[model samples]
Target: MAGDPPTTPSSTQTGVPNNGNNPSPSEDPNNGNSPSSTDFASLPSATATGDINSTDKGLDGGAVAGVAVGCLIAGLIIGAIVMWLVFRAKGSRYTRRRRRSEDRGRLMHSTRDANLVALESSRKPMKLENFILQPAPDKEIISDLSRLDDIIRQHVETVYHFEPVDVKVTALAHSLTAIGYSERLSGLQVEDVATWCLQTETRCGALRHVLSHVLFSSIDWNSPGALTLLPQPAIGFLNSIRPIGEYRNNFDVMSFAWTRWRTLSALFLHPSPQERTPLEVSEDDIQGQVETLAKALDPVLRYFVAPDEESQHQQHDHLRVMIMETAKLGYTLFSHTSDWKFIYRDDSGKRCPVLCIGLEKLCGSDGYRLVSPQRIVEPRVMS
Candidate 1:
């Protein structure tokens, strides 16, 4: 449109002529300029051609570069949004998992609290049906030793009554050797361990003192009817209480103290199944038991009994009557501390008296139950 017009339509051929391969126009003298042309046949046989390529690509380089940059930007933006969504979902899942764990912990605590409250609300005073026999070691031997009958009745009862706490037999037994009594262990050692250490009365320390308690309560050494009498505690409780008339004006107080103590002691000792019953107890043993009981009771009985022998028949009769009353009172005092939980039995599966604090309060027919240490029995004497 400016200086030179565009070329017109022209016939073009890519092959060589059949005459021969034509030479370049500059190399041939006859091949001159093409200022004018009328027909294709009159044109020079050897004509040079300019390299020109035709294309329909109207899009500019700047436009194509822009398209490529835009495509690259779109891909990165989509990738970032997808990655953010994935990370957000994962974070939300972790938060839900953490919250679930905390909720489970809270639920468990709530359940435990509810159970404890229910148990406390259902607690009640124990009866015979709720009793169980699971005393601590101290109480175990205390009740067992009482079954020895005559050994305790004739002397130990005369002084210590049946109070194992007062006798401290195990402690007393241990003390025998400590008091300088080098007696080898033997069957007779129980009775003679104290006497062997007579020479070192001061060396006895707590040993002789414990022995003194046992001498009257275990060996029954203080009994007027005892076959063997040994060195007794110089300051025994019985010694202090035995003073008569003016010396023992306040002795009546001891009776009250003793009765209350015995009642308290009954709480710790439960009657087991007949088979599970720890010690074999019988009637002859009862007499010894009675005598042992009488030691503490006699002091009170003297308060009612006539001292003069002239009324001996009447006194004997009165004592016989009072003795029955005393036994009944003691039995009543002890029996109340427990109740019948099941049918009396001695075997493993038989009904037994269980401790009231645990499942002992429940019927054995129900199921096995756990023991509770918190459910304590009051066994100490109240002021």
Candidate 2:
């Protein structure tokens, strides 16, 4: 021990003695031999298998995300297609509903028109004797006469196809005759009679203008049969009337006769002459003529009923119907003159007013008063 280098125990000598089964330090588990083999096994291979596994996992995640995105897009496309189909279906249904509504409205209107024609055809003419009477008060008699006149007008309009210009003229003529009879019996100067005549003359002049314009414009003057049909009353009437540019006095005798002739000829020539195709009038045109004629007639009718309590109510109702009809036809009520005032006392005894032809007012205590014609009282004479 003294001579030897301090023999620190060799790792093999210091340790407990190794059994035969136990290996030396060079082969021990703690030595580099087994540990190197274990570490070599534990460490990653040159092939980098963990990195390959990580790359595979990343690829799998990307595929799943792509599938999710694709599903979302496909769902959106499907939803859009469904919405489009739904809206298109709704539009078609709405269109069909609108078409049905329009068709139903047209059918309803046609049915109503046909019913009106049937009713009008079945109605009888009104008798004038029921309303007009002699030896009555001026107010009562005028009211009755107005009612009779309106009934007659309505009857004529219903029965006749053409404008009832003659009917108004005839009614006016009867009223003039009645007034003349009243004047002789009562010795009362009903100045309203002269006013009525003047107004009627003005209306007749306007009606003549309208008729002449329509007839002349529509007639085929150059047709082969135009000259030969001299016996036809329409042609004769047109020839009798004054030309467009020439000035004629109101209430011309020829114009009155032509009005009557035109009415009769229209009645006789229902459906119109086949050769007179150019003169074929539309229903709208005829309706316009009727509306104009009604406008001319309204003032006269209002004048007669303006003084009566009972007839005023009836007049108002009739006027309302006329107004509604005129509105439907797109026409305005016009008067020949504007100075006359139709006055009626209200529930509060206040006067309601409407315009007429002269400054003459239809208001009085007895519901009857004389209306002076504008021409009758000269300004110089009055001054």
Candidate 3:
């Protein structure tokens, strides 16, 4: 029975038929059936179903955006902290520099010579009450005086508004040109010039020097014989009776002395002297001479005074009264030479070389350092 041709299992016993070349119902491509287990096993993974039904939508867009925003916020916080630290460091440095400057200022004041303080304090303005006002030399004179005063006020305001480093070098070049030094001022940096001009003492000195140059410009300083700083008519009068060589040596000294003492007197004295000596010149004569000279010098004064008329008139009347008062004080000094000493001396009772020096030479020095050229507004009287 075991040798009865080893009967093959029927199709009912096995799921597949015994024919080796034939395909099963599941394996028939044209039958429209699913793959059999063998076909599925032949693929990459037998247990893996095609994509499982998942509720997770990977990486929500909102979450990605939130993470990016968080990163941006962190970056902003770091940047702000960095900026704050940088500014704080700069503030600390600025504080240290300020403290150093304060210390230096204290040292400077402590080491200053006592004479400088006394010298600064001794400069007193003449009281208008001391002298009676002479008649207006001329209506024209008053107008010119007003214009001059306006120019000074305008310059003060302009420079006040200008930043030290920011001020143009050319801003002062016209003034330099007025004094015939514009070329010399070439190539100078604006910052250096502005810093020098911005100093109160230096600014005042420069202005006074310019005034002196303009007022006494008619005088011939380059003459070979005794160099007289006095303008023509007064020069003729002072040289009319030539004093001894001692007085001759001091002619320039006296001229500078008289200039600082009486700025307006330069305008008051005629280019040619009258029959009367300075000692005999009456108040009425002085007033007449001042009016005449004022008419004559108007053109020259106008050029320097209002180089830029537009700017000068911009700020009107702020310092006009004060300037007028100073001008009045100057006019009072126009009386006979008998009222004021013609000799120049330092506070130490010695002759000041500065009085003998040219105004140009003196201009090179710090105005506060020179004692002879009194300021236009306030002349320093010896105590």
Candidate 4:
């Protein structure tokens, strides 16, 4: 022991053994001499773990943001494409509609031109002197027209139809005569007479109103063969001849009625050379229309004429004369003068106001003063 270096005693040599149950003071579990197996220094630092977790979260967030941006761009592209398609569709529809409207306009103009051409082709030339209108004598078969004359003469001098007083009187007299022959209407009521006179004047007024538009009666209604030759005014005159609601107002129907009116008007103005024979209109449509018109006007005639068949026949003859004279006078006035118009029912369907006692003759009176017109018997005439 003296020669050797000082050797620490082993646990066995020192007579105390290190075992599971006992240990030296330096190795004691309670002493702080040795490091323990569960020491806190052996674990990772808090800052280092937090840095790793933060890097993983950053990667995940970047992926989500990239996907969201890609979806937004795709949605915008799709919205733009849809808007383009919608506008293009609307534009195409509008173009198609405009083309159709243009086509309809061209068709209407062409149809009108064709009708005019056909009318001029098959017409015969005749002088107006062959079928001129004549005024009624003061004492022709009827004696009670004095009051009617007084009423007519007062307005005749005015520029109602812009005609001479004589012409107006002749036209109005023929119009009233056409209601029925003098003998047939002897038993009728005063109200009926007023009705007949008012209606005739109204029809005449309507004719003249349209005549003011188409004054070239010589170039216009020079022949009575075809309806196509007829001016629009002629068509309007025929349509207005019948009271409103009497027949269908279709163009074709009105054209047919015009043919009938023209034929009858011609016959009355110029009797057939044979006298007993029917007037010879070139178109078969005119002949058929004449018969049709007779039947159509029968109901109208029955209201004013006597029930006898002979009286009815005579009344139709007179009616034809009336229409012819009114047309003749209307043509004369429109051709010669420029200051007249018939005041039709207002757009609201109200009657025209009573302006002056000298111009308009009311159908009836309440005591001495006239009441508001229930019906526009004679439409007001004005300059």
Task: Highest TM-score: give the candidate number.
Answer: 1
**Which has the higher lDDT value, candidate number 2 or candidate number 3?**
3
lDDT of each: 0.34, 0.37, 0.39, 0.38
Model 3 earns a TM-score of 0.24
Candidate with maximal lDDT: 3
Q: Give per-residue lDDT, candidate 3, residue 336.
A: 26
Inter-residue clash pairs, candidate 3: 233-271
User: Candidates 1 and 3: which is better by TM-score?
Assistant: 1
Task: Give one digit per residue, the lDDT tens place, for model 1 in 82-185.
Answer: 99999999999999999999999988886666543332234763333233222224243334223322232222223221111223334544544433222221
Model 3: weakest 10-residue lDDT segment is 352-361
Better of 1 and 2 by lDDT: 2
Predicted candidate 3 versus true structure: per-residue lDDT over 186-292, tens digit per residue: 22333343334554445533333333323322222222123222333554655565442356656655544443333334434533333222222234434443444
lDDT of 2 at 241: 59
Instruction: List the candidate 3 regions with Cα displacement exceeding 4 Å.
Output: 1-160, 164-195, 198-311, 314-328, 339-383
The lDDT of model 3 is 0.39
CA deviation > 4 Å runs, candidate 1: 1-55, 119-383
Worst 10 residues of 1 by lDDT: 354-363
